[model samples]
Each structure stands twice: as structure tokens, then as C-alpha cells.
Target: MEITYTEAVILYCLKQLKGERTIFSLYHLYQGKKSSQTIQDAHLYHLTPFFQAFPFISREELARQIERMEKKSLLDKKSNEHFILTSTGDLKLGEYFQANTLPPKYLDGWRHHHLTALFWERLSILVQVCSNLVYQKKSFIPIQNKLETLDWVKAFIKKRQEGRMGLSSTLFLELLNCFQRDKTIDPSILVLRLTGQDRIGLTSGQAAELLGMDHTRYQLEFLNILHFLIGTVSDEAVEFPLLNALIPEAEKPVPFTLSTEKTFQLLNRGYTVEQISRIRNLKRSTIEDHIVEIALHIKNFDLAAYVPKDKEKRILEAAKETSAKKLKLIREYAEDASYFEIRLVLARNGDQKWK
Candidate 1:
């Protein structure tokens, strides 16, 4: 049987989304990959709302698409956990990968689409959150107990920003209004709600109090309404930031190279963070971070052989000079956290620092 252009393209998209089960699952469901009890549930409960968030297709249409994809063998229907791509799907995906290099616009700006979806997904849960808060407020005593209101708010924020839900601006404003009416609401709670930095969404009573109310049902309901608002219909278009949260005080940069280098060196030596902390005179968390940077640089260029020899030498030397003298100037402008201190250091040293 001859494959149509649309079917081929759909197959290609499926292959491109190889490992992201949620994404492929949505595509599979839309393509009509298979019809089973589990697939039905995934479609009705998970994929449907997810698609609604993007305003891409109706729930019924999505299921139909999944069935179609299954008939074509582009998507494997047997697995409940993930949508495994078939050989035909792989070949189609390879065709697109080779023939169509992504435009710079997509490469650079695709992140924004993802970030926006994540924001909206979280916002969807705000209504449920407020409804619950209202429930507690009306009930006289807190429904969740010493469980601070801020904690629930934090968890919801984390869930939404984490790209686990569809957030919306309307929901955001509603939440703000809730806090306004309840002046007792802490600003930290609001901060946690937006940034997902702290604990905000702890549940009432459970072994894992952290579980809180699994807002999946709440998310599903608001997901439909939000899709109409954002003006999209498919889960594919839904996007959120992969790394969209603030770094904590512990993550702040320290000003020394040997400290950075040694921390990394110890970590590479297979030392646990705690071991590294004890061995090196730095905090365990700080040592663990050094491991990350060291791994990044090594992955980019060989650190052991390159250090004090080639490109790595020049880079480190520059970093050190910048660290020792130039960095001191930026310390005064501490309030300007967004600015890069490395650049400030380089600017101060001018030609003297680069050698």
C-alpha cells in the first residue's frame, strides 16, 4: 500500500518524538494506534485534556487518529506505559531528519512555545487550588491542617511549571485575587506559586503528605477551558521551559578556580558528594555542583589532558584573572543578579586579563 504524504509526515513526527512517551502517546492516540481498555483510559483521561490544552483536536478525533496510527503500524499499541515507534515510523522520521533541517527560528524560539504551555498548564490547576482553599476557609478549620496554605500553592506551582499541567493567565489572576482577599497569605506563597521554588502543595493526611490532592482530575477539567482560551487544540504545541526555575542561594557562584577545579576533580574520582565535601574543604552541595560543571567541560573538551596545555588552559587562565580582580567590582552591584559577573570581570581587566 502506498503511504500518503500526511501519513508519512505524521510518522516522521512520531519518530522525532522517539523517547517522550507522553508526546508520542498523544500522537499515537490522535493517529488511532490501538483500541484497548488502557489505551481508552489514557486517551479519555490523559491525552484528551493534554490535546485540549493545545486546542489541536477533539477527544473523539484524537482517539480516531490513534486508531489510524495503530492500523498503519506507525505506533505500537500493546505497551501501556510508552508508545514505541515502529520500523516504518523510524524510516519516515529519518526522511524528515535528513531532508528538512530545522530553520533557526524553530531551533532558537521553540523553547518559548514549550515554556508558555508549561505556564498555562499550571495555571489550569489554580481554579482547583482556589476551590480547595475556599473549602478550607469556609470550613472554619483548615481541611489540610498545620499544612500551610503556602505549601499547597508551592506544589501546584511546581507541578504546573514542571510541564505536568496546562497553566493559564486567568487562573493566575484568580489565584492572586484569592490571596488578596485572604491578606494572611504570605508573599513566599505567591513566590512559590509562580516560580515553584518552595513547598506549596502538600496534601491533608497521608503517609506521604507531599502527595496532597492529585490534581489530575482538576487539571483535566481546566485543561479543556484553557485550550479555548489559548486557542490551540493539540498536545504537541503545548510547550514549557525545560529549566524555568530560580537558582537558590546555595547555587550562587563562588569566586575561586582551585575550589571549582578541586571540587570537580574529587567528584570525577567517584567520590560521593558527602565524601568530596569531607575530602575537599567545601560544603557537600557545593562539591556536588563542581562535579556537574566539570562533567560539562569534560564532555565539551578533555579536561585532564587539555588543562594548562591547550584551549582549556587559556579559558581557565582567563576565568582566574577575571575571578581574582575583575569579579570584585561587580560585588557592589549585587542587586543586579541578572547581569553576568564574568563579563564585568573581563571588562575591568580589558586586554590584561585575556593572556
Candidate 2:
């Protein structure tokens, strides 16, 4: 069965999350939700970067798609807020992969990698240098102004030229072949146009104009192409040394604050939130916040200890009805629900408005 891009993305997200996920969590992963903290506080949740900029789909539209998929038996509602891929859904997802010439496992793994601002910065610089080198240009301005990044690129190009380590024309041809198989025109052109061949490549701005698109939109398309290329090549890194070399080695630190770590340690030791609050000299609300953050990041964290399953249902219902981010408003609808339970529901559901 054919699926829209949004449907495909949803199926892909559910598949990646191991075939079960709350709508909130799925949404968070799709759009790359960030933690509430400004300075990397303990309650902050680490988020993986996603291709949110290119897509015009909204949460409401996503919810509608989920409902439609469920009705079509492509998805099974495991609970009020959680969903799983049905056997039919799995088959449909498989079809999607086959149609796109993509490997499901690799796409899933790509979703988990932390694509940071620095990764994109390095990617832009690398693309520029590689493009110049491909065209046999002796000198060109680096995309990045940073000396360290320029030095790294220079060394990397030198190594490649010296036949030490780098991508070859054969690899570029393979990449182009892959791009040619894609449904969109921009992806192939973006790849070829960005990596110059016997001619200096166009800058992103020039490419955007040439493609009759705004610079920002063109950049988003460019990023989407780059992201797909990186993910696909990384999946076969053993065979594609050049693509593998471009993979960023820097790891993002776990999304836990020192205080949250203490809270998690205490909770693991069977300490109640109230007990931990007093022991740690922090407020009960603060401790609860830590638990919420923990639940958001750590899938195995036991939310049942704080909010019962029945209460969870009520919180979800209230949240859906009101669509309010404020704790006070949510509490009005879920009268018996404590602030902690409400927060837990919102966090698990990946509601960023409250945060």
C-alpha cells in the first residue's frame, strides 16, 4: 500500500522506537524537542536532531494521521496514548522501505544519532572542500571560518589526495546512482550541484536561486538530502570509507543533570520522591521534575510508581481535551490529578508547550 510522507515518517518513528510509543514521544522525536533548561539544568532532556524544518506537517495533522492509520489497521492502539505497529503495519512499513530502496534498520539507527549544530557546520565545510577537490581546484575559501575546522579539512583533503584516506570517483558515482533512484529531483541535483565536478560548485544561495526556491527552503532541502546520504552511507561504512570518514566522532553527553542523576540514583535505591527531596535538600516539586525528565529520556524509568495506569488515562484525556500547557489549566480538567502526575503525563506524551 502507498503511504504519504507523513504516514511514512510516523511508521518509521514507531518502528524505530521498537514498534510501541506514546504519541507525545513520537512527536518529540519527529520534531526534535529540546529540554526546558536554558543552561543545561538537571531536568533537561537530550533530544536528537530531526528533519523538522522541511516538513510542513503539524501535530494536529499528525494526530489525524495516527487515527487514520489505526482505522486502516496499519497501527494498533496499545493503550489510550501508546500505539504499536500491527502485522499489517509492519508489512506496510516494509513496503515503504522497498519502494524507497531504503533499509529499515539503518533508517531507525539514523534517527537515534545526535545530529547537532556542530555536525551540520562540519558537514557544510566538508562538502565545500570535497566539492573543490573533486573539481581539482587548487584553492577555495572554506565554508567555515574556524581555523581548527579549516585545518582539519585541509589535513583531511591532503590525506585523501595522498591516497591515504578519502572518497573516490567510484564512491561519488555510487552516491549519484542512489540519488537518481529517489523520487524527488532536488535530492539528486542538490548532491551533484553541491559537489562540483570539473567546475566550481554553486554556493547554497546560488543553488537556491537557480532552483527557483528561497534560500531557507533550499537549505532545508539540502540538509534533508545530506542527512539521508550520511545515514545511508554510514549504514555501509565498511564499504564506503569516504562517507565513514565524514561521520562525526564527537558524542553528545547523556541528557542528565547532576541533580537529576542524584534523583535517579535515589529512586533506583527505592527512595520515595518525598524522602529524596528532604534528603537532597530540594523541594518535592523539584524532585518530581527530575523524575519527569528521567522518564522522558530513560524508557525503563517506572512511571507507575508515581501515576497509576487509571490516573494516566485521565491525565491523557484531560490533556487532549484542553490542549493547555499550563499545569493549573490541566489540573482544572483532571481535578484529582496531582501536579506530579500531570507533569508525568505531559512529559511521557512529549508535550513541549508546558515545558
Candidate 3:
């Protein structure tokens, strides 16, 4: 029997994890946990693209999926929770992938997760509105009902320099340009889900069935196209100007959690982790998480303030020598490095891949 898309994702994560972590690590990774450790795991395991790829999944659902894999001999349980992929499992995973079963190509859950859904919301509403306005029709239900999104759309349309005809044409051209630039993208995945004028868009399940895909398969494909558009429009704004304007400006700079942003502002004024903890009335460990999260996103963020340069170098060296990301393992090689110091270095190394 063919493995399902969800199973493939689990199998791929298991392979990347290399039996070092428990199956639940994949669970948290898929959920896109906001914790520092979960964020670090995403990069350390080279699973950044798949991070938060399945936020709707429940722990019970994950347990069921793992049970299914075990039944298929794709996974062998070790110590109750940890699992190592069996040879048959590895072979199956390879075969499944060889069929071009739609593994993620441009997911980028790390960079674009926060904005992907929002962009699609704005685009969907804009498309529906433009479709009706160009035809001189009024009084239609909006595709998005969130008050914030509704307000944003109204503001967006009012700010547009194009008339209904010009807006529709430019939007069409910009969208066409985005898909054409990414030759691998299949626009039909998006078009099939989009609604316009009198035509209501298909529900995700409806679209998936129509395209001969499982709902999960269609979700992954749709995310790929969405992220690709976000990346393309961001990088080549001059090319997709109309679409570029749709990107949320507030989130344009950084995608920090609200609490992390609060810490970031204090950090800008030079608060020590301890001081930030005191100021925020949170534990020191919690503040440390904020610091690590900062290092993960802000590439130029200074670490010398937290970890000595020599120590940072040693931690990174140990990481390279062992080819291991687990703090306990790297600690053995860098005997003098503290776990916090090791984490600080790894956070940067995970992204930069420094030698």
C-alpha cells in the first residue's frame, strides 16, 4: 500500500532526526512550538522547511500516526517514546519519494509561517472584491470575515492607485508573473481554491478531492505556492509590485512572538538577561529563551555579550567535530562550554553553517 502524505512527513522527519530524539520532537516541530528548544530543533535537524507545517495536528493524532508507522514496520520503538526508522521504513520512504509524491519544495515555515496565511487571506479577499468591482457588481459576501483582515482589505483597496479595470489587470499580471518566475509552481493548485464574483471557491477538502489529492497533500502544495509567492514578491518587488503591496508591513521586519518583541525592545537599550527577567517579572530562563530566539532571526545579533568569543568558537568547533546538535553530546567535546553557551553558538551555527 502507498504511504500517505502525513506518513511521508513523519518518515522524513524520523530520518532527519537520526534516532537522537523522541517521536514527539516531530510533533512539536510540526506544531511550530514557540519554545526556544523547538525553534532550535527545527534548524539543528535541518527540518526548518517543515517546521509548523502541521499546526492543526493534535497530539492524539500524532500518536495515531506513529502507531500506524510502527504497524507498517516503518518505525521501531526504543524506550517507549524514541523511534528509529527500520531498514524497511527507510526503503519505503525512499520509494515513496521517488514517485515524486510532493515533498515540500519552498515551504519556508521558518521565515514565512506567520505571513503565509495572512497574505492568502488578503489576496483572496482582494481577488474576490476586484472580480466583482470590475464587473460593476456590489453586495457580495467577503471571502475573509476576520475584522482585522476586513479592515486591512478596505484600507488596501482605498489606497490602490488603479481603477477597478486597472487594478484587476495589474493584479492578474502580477499574479501571473509570480507563478511564471517560479517555473516549478503549479498555479492550478491556487486557482482551484480561489473564489471570484458569483463563483465560490472550493473548500480545502473539495479542492483536494477534485485534484486527486488527499487534503493534507493539497495543503502542502498550497503552502508551497503561497510561500513561493511571498518569497518571490519580497525579493523581486519591482516585478510583482501589486502583490508586494499585499505583504503585511508590520511583520515585514521580523516575525517575533509578542513577548519576544517586548524583550527585543528592552534588549535594544542594553538590558542583561537577568535585568530583562526582573523587568518583565519572568524567570531568567524565560528571558534566555527570548535571547536565543533573537539570535535565530537577527543574523547580526551580537553574542559576545552573552558568550565569550573563545567559548563561542569552542562550542561551534565541538558542534562541527561531533556533527551533533544535542547539547549533552556537544558538551562532551567542548568540556568548558555551558549548555547556555553551547545553545547560543548552535543557534547561530544552525543558520550560518559556519566551519
Candidate 4:
């Protein structure tokens, strides 16, 4: 089935998460919410790369797409908060994968960089120089205006040549193959233009007009394509030193908030939430929120430590019946189960199967 980019992205995210995800989490991921360290660490925000391509999409519009997808039987509403891809949706996504070379939202980690413009500028300049050199043209003017950048690119090219013969050719061929296989022509043309391929090469402004895209959208697409190429080539660096040198380092560790780290430390020491709250001079509710955040981030966190087996059984049953949407309704069904316990159960097991 033919699906819009938004629908395709939604399906891809659901499948990647094993066919189930909360609406809230999905929205936060696509909207690129920075509040949650766990989401950032996982590189879950896929929409940031295409902000210009999808300028019209908003959180509200995304929610509408989810509803539309559910109505189309592309997704099954498992609960008020979560949805799972249906068999039809799975088959459709499989078709998309078979037809498309580049995975949807492939350069999601680019959003994490603070100096994205510099990264792209340096990369494009390097590619242009390398492509020209491979074609045996040494007299071309530098695409980058800065003297420092020109010097750096010159030294970088020299180092690769000294390390291995045909390194530049190998890197350029790999990039060409990746772009040629892509479902979209824009990315391939963008890369070709940037690298100064003989017939198709054009300046950025000229390429944007040829592709019928605005300058911003064209630039965003080009950057995403470059990022994807860097990632793909970097993985095979053991065989391609030139590619390895071109790609940047992986993301740094995501830091937890001081309060959340303190709460985690206390919990690790076997302190009860109440005890932690008393010792830390915070409310019990605040302590519980910290525990939830910890459980969400730490895969092996023991939710059972706070919720007894019998009480967990009651909460799971109530959650299954009512979809875990409203905690108050769950509390009514699960008599004597504290709100915190209910929240914990929902947080840990809402999208997964209950024991």
C-alpha cells in the first residue's frame, strides 16, 4: 500500500519498537522532546532531520495521523495510551523496506550535534575535493571559502593518499552506490551535485531550484544524506580508513539530572521511597516520580521491589481491562493499591505482556 512519509515514519517507529509504543512516547520522539534523557540516549527522535521537509507537521497533526492510521487498520489500538502494528501494517512496511534503499529517518543522531552547520560544510567541501581529485583534476578552486578549512581538507586528503592507494576512489564509490540505491532521487542528486559529478553537478542554489525545493529543505535533505553515508561507511572502517576518517565520533553519554541521579543512588542502596523522601527532605510523590524515571531508563530495574506480587496481579488485570489510561479508574478496580504502585506497573508493563 502507498503511504505518506508521515505514515511510513510512524510504521517504522512502531516496528522498530517491536510493534508496540505509547502515543505519548511516539509524539515526544518525533517532536524531538529534550526533557527525557532516556529518549535522547536511544536516539529516538527521527523527525528533527526533516524539520524543513515536514514544516507543516505538528504534534497535533501527528496525533491526527496516528488516529488515521489506526482507522485504516495499519495499527491496532491496544490501549488508550498505546498501539501495536497489525498484520496488514507489518506487510505494508515490509513492502516499503523492500522497495526503499534508505531507511526512513536514517540520520536521526544528527539532531544531537551543536555544530551541525560546520559538520556539513566540512563534509561537503571534503567530498567535492575528493571527487575532483579522483577524476584527476588538481586545478579547481576550493569550494570552501575559509583558508583554514582549505588547509585542513588539503592535509586530510594527503594523509589518506599516504595511507593507501585508491582510498579516495573506494570512499566515493561507496557513497555513489548508497545514493543510487535510494528510493528518493533528491538525495542521490544532492550528493552528486555536492561531489561535482560531471553532468549532474550543480551549486547548492541551482540544485535546490532543479529539485523544486526551497533552500532550507534542500540543505536539510543533503545533510541527512551525508550523515547516513558517514554512518554506513564508518561501520566498514576496518577495511576503509578514508571513510573512517571522514565520519565523526559517536554521541557522548547523556547525563541524568542531579536529583534523578541522587534518587537512583538512594534506591540502589535499598532505601524505601518514603525513607528517601524523609532523608532528602522531599515529598514522597517526588521520590516516586524519580523511581518511575529510573525504571523507564534502566532496563533491569526491579519494579516488583516496590509492588508486591499479589498487588501486581490486581493492577495488571485492571490495566488489561481499562487500557491503563486513567489511574483513578485503575485504583478503583485494584482496591488498596496505592497510586504510585499503579503508576509503576503501568510504566513498566504498559506496552509489554503481563506475567
Candidate order by TM-score, decreasing, is 3, 2, 4, 1
Q: Please give the range of 10 consecutive residues that has the lowest summed lDDT in model 4.
A: 38-47
Give me the displacement of residue 335 in model 1, in angstroms.
47
Tell me the TM-score of model 2.
0.54
The lDDT for every candidate, in the order shown, is 0.38, 0.61, 0.84, 0.62
lDDT of 3 by residue, 105-207 (tens): 8888877888888889999999999999988998898989999998988888888887899999999998987787768778989998788989999988898
Best by TM-score: 3
- Model 1 RMSD in Å is 19.2
Q: Per-residue lDDT for 86-159 in model 4, tens only? A: 99998888787776533434554423333334555666787777667667776776666888778777777676
**Tens digits of lDDT, candidate 1, 1-355:** 4444444434544443343344445544443332222133232222222222223445566456656877887778545534557787666556655644222111111112223344343342344444444334322222232343436445656666423233445345433543454353233322322322122433212212223322332222233233232222122122312212211111222222466676665555767667777876777555534543343323343334222234333433544543332233333333332123232222222224222
Where does model 4 exceed 4 Å of error? 1-28, 36-125, 128-167, 176-287, 324-326, 350-355
Residue 33, candidate 4: alpha-carbon lDDT = 46
Give TM per candidate: 0.24, 0.54, 0.93, 0.51
When 1 and 4 are scored with TM-score, the better candidate is 4
Off by over 4 Å in 3: 101-103, 352-355
Instruction: Please give the TM-score that candidate 4 achieves against the real structure.
Output: 0.51
For candidate 2, the per-residue lDDT at 39 reads 18
Model 2 / residue 234 / CA error / Å: 4.6
The whole-model C-alpha lDDT of candidate 1 against the native structure comes to 0.38
Tell me the deviation in Å of residue 289 in model 1: 10
